[model samples]
Target: EVAVLANQTTFFGESGGQQGDAGVIKTENGAIIEITDTQKKLGALHVHLGKVTEGDVKVGDAAEFRVDHARRSSLRANHSATHLLHAVLRKHLGDHVTQKGSLVAADRLRFDISHPKAVTAEEAAVIEADVNSLIRENSEVTTRLMTPDEAIELGAMALFGEKYGDEVRVVSMGEPVANEHAYSLELCGGTHVKRTGDIGMFKIVSEGAVSSGVRRIEALTGADAANYMSARENVLATVAADLKAVPEDVPARVKALQEERRRLEREVSDLRKKLATAGSGATSGGDAFKEVNGVKLALRSLDGIPAKELKGMVDELREQMGSGIVALVSGDGGKASIVVGLTEDLKDKYSAVDLVRIGVEKLGGKGGGGRPDMAQGGGSDPSQADAALAAIEAHIAG
Candidate 1:
């Protein structure tokens, strides 16, 4: 479909982490149609789409076409730069690599590639330098069209599970090399520059692995790169001034600052430990052997009882409770905790794990436990704590 001022064209843009391109088109009437947005879609036909706007015009009308010259140029540089970077990555990291996604802006391009390990700063610098070197070498950007069978025969690499028609678009960088020194060549439909040099001042600012085997890279070229560097330098200058240090001395200064910070953290941790000790009291060792269902039961309360400490106390207190039933309750920081212990002699209907599970549930919370001898669980519902205790006391008796 078409209109007087603008025509609808599918453009693939920064959706799904892939950055869209900025371009413009024009009508024959000299009315400029700016292609301000591009998008890629997950659909049947026309994977890439573009939107253009101008004076009101109906569809089914013919309109002239033009892409935003400056924006398109910059985007092409970055997009083409991605190809160069892709080639460099394969050269260094081998052919197991594949493009996960990409974002191309006026001056910067971010590429996500599949790899197992995090890309180090040195590796990113190398990749950037390599791409820039190729650009400086001025590789010709050549385009070729071939049938699917012909592309396969010519040893062109293609994406996995991608649907292709009888004809495909191929973009090549530089002259083809023999076995190894090849520059860059891939099948692509996105717009690109005519030459690698058009992507002035390629650089890789950062790189990191996204997942177990996928990596991400952000790079800049031309003015975007220049601005980033300048901003970084300004930050360094400000920090240096604050520290009364030189530019190169900032790292050492920052390291010393970090050490000071760690020392303060340790001091705070020690103070917290001391405060906890002062407030926490050890569990009491007094009463036990409450009779339930003609079986001796175990119960106790102690201060400063950690979850593990409570478990230990409960284990020791169990023997005294005998084969009847054992239940332990302790409070920590105003929160209620409990553990259940049963004897092997009466393990048939009574289970420590099941007991604890029920205890936590009836208490309006959740809990879990272990074997027939003992299990542990706790809940945050302090109001239901007493009811929970009474329920467990009767549960073991039953």
Candidate 2:
């Protein structure tokens, strides 16, 4: 642990929803200690965390400290962009816009604000355009130390739930308006870019409702934003090529393809139903029967037949067979579904549920319960379908 005095250190601690600065400290003995994180305690002391990988690092040893410039630059870019985004939101959404929460990372930033509804796509586009306009203007960023009352008098915004001392740090961006105040002036302690143009660019990647009356905007800046836009362009180009259409016509092409798919689906379903009735003597499937105790036992397995059409098939078969029992099983792979239908005469003697339960058991499956006239059950193993059908016949025979 290395203690960092206020003005003696250049690293900024983790605060204001922003990550801490990371760097390394080179000791007198040529040993290097990596400082992966910096944090400020309640007592205003900065603590640096890392381990000495080389020679021993003793306390009170003078060391050369350095902060990772690239990482700090990215964080500073995103942090300053967050302030501009807040201002843009307030300008478009309403004066009621207040910061609910925020997270400033090197790759992206998330800003939560008070809003009654989700930001529409049009509103988001306008807000993003407004922010990029400020970036293009290259507005100046100013920081000053002033009393809290004085900062508030200048219309500086203070975050809710934040504890501020009598003396607070005020950060402002953009030129002074008629009120002699910058467009965005907030009582913040986080590090920021020297000018709005230093942010390079700003883009809102997503917007959504986080909670009741609260909305969140996730955005990226600088190289991160550039990379995001490049990736999206590549995806759109690929999709357009696949659709054989220009980027502007891709949506219409996709809609046409979907309509074609639905048409093909309906045609295939009708053809399948027609083919099923060809030799089956019914829409469900072809039925064969065996005589058992003066009752006709009709059974057939309708492979690939939908469950919805199974009942109609059984009913038609019962009408043709007239005085027997109908048992149908259908499905694919290792799954099976069985339906049983009883003739008016057999309904009084043998139960359809009992026959279905006995059939499912042979297939190592479950489910069978209904009136004596009709019942349905399913099995996990389709390999035993033949044996299950035989079991159904034997159950009725006994």
Candidate 3:
């Protein structure tokens, strides 16, 4: 292990929220060991974890290792973008914002900052825009080693509880000729892009409160950000085409649909009440009334009436009929709705739930249960509605 640690390597180990470099090591004898991860421990010791995929590797063997450059570039871009995002948050949300923690990965970045309140969507958009603007400026990212006091004097932000030696590495991104204090300056030891422009693009994918007074923002940089935007645009286009409207007019079209739906709902409700009144007039005396086993019953099948209106219809029937078992079946298409209501007097003799169950069973459906005074159920076969009502009537007679 010490021999592997002692080997002179150009690969950078994991530090400051950035991932370690990954690659493979080849021995002089053509043996290969895959280096999955590299981490720094005990000051400057680079611990490498790997498996020997080829021949045996002994102590003190000479080996050549290659770092994954593409992966490293991605890490560098995301890491640098975190710094810019931090600066932007502090700028837009006021200096009360401070870095809490972060995770800088090759594919995405997460930044945790201390803020009193949750970030709003508008604020997140502004912060993202500011970060992207900084990337467009292509500010020079510079790193320097100085005393902790000197770094602090330059307004370099330091992490809480982090032990810093006399010499600290300070990372700063800015065009000093414009404003030295304008960019992000922090004490960090992670790898980063050489210039802000290297990030290519910046986007905040999501933001939320991670803890009390701490908010987290997850984002993508470079091609990842561009790809996310492209995919979102494609989804919007598909939705617009489905609605037969252009993307710019989609919101208005959706709003119009909602209004139309509400208007139709009111109209349907009015028509149901009118129809119920007309049916009551036609059968008010004795047309739909019958006597089964000495119990008065009123049975009727109505068409195109919604299940939601069945309860109201049952209520109206209970009020007018005074005493009886009212079984009403109404439906359209292939669906059927059955509602059974018993007057106050008949509720003790028979259960409304039992009546509804009889109807639903004859119609070959499930999910039927309710109270004694009123119960409702639905079935898929509307054509069987007549048989369902007949079954209920037979049950009452028997």
The whole-model lDDT of each prediction reads: 0.68, 0.83, 0.84
Order of the predicted models by lDDT, top scorer first: 3, 2, 1
Please give the lDDT score at residue 306 for candidate 2: 69
Model 2 Cα shift for residue 215 (angstroms): 3.7
lDDT-wise, the better of 1 and 2 is 2
Which candidate, 1 or 2, has the higher TM-score? 2
**Which ten residues in a row are the worst by lDDT in model 1?**
276-285
Model 3: lDDT of residue 287: 61
- For residues 1-398, what per-residue lDDT tens digits would candidate 2 score against the true structure? 44444345788889989998888878788888788888887747777777776787776777888999999999999999999999889989999999999999988999999999989999999999989988988988999999999999989999877889879999999776686789889999999999999999999999988999999999999999999999999999999999888999998999999999999977866675444334352222354556777788777755776666667777776887788888877776557878888988877798999998988887788777778999888888766666777788777778
Q: Give TM per candidate.
A: 0.59, 0.79, 0.72
TM-score-wise, the better of 2 and 3 is 2
Model 3 ranges off by over 4 Å = 1-4, 40-45, 176-182, 262-398
Over the full model, what C-alpha lDDT does candidate 3 score relative to the true structure? 0.84
Give candidate 2's error at residue 95 in angstroms: 4.2
Stretches > 4 Å off in candidate 1: 1-34, 38-62, 105-107, 175-181, 205-212, 264-398
Superior by TM-score: candidate 1 or candidate 3: 3
- Backbone atom clashes (below 3 Å) for every candidate: 27, 1, 0
In candidate 1, what are the lDDT values of residues 1-398, reduced to their tens digit?
Answer: 23122235534444423356555555455444555555545432222233445654444446654445777777788888888888889888878888887777766789988888877767777777778788888878987899877766666666665778779877788556686424676767667888778877876688786777889888888778778888999999999999999999999999999999999967765554333223232221233355667767655433334566556555555654456666666566766677777777878877888877776776566757688878877777655655666677777667
lDDT of 3 by residue, 273-305 (tens): 656544442223436466789987777677888
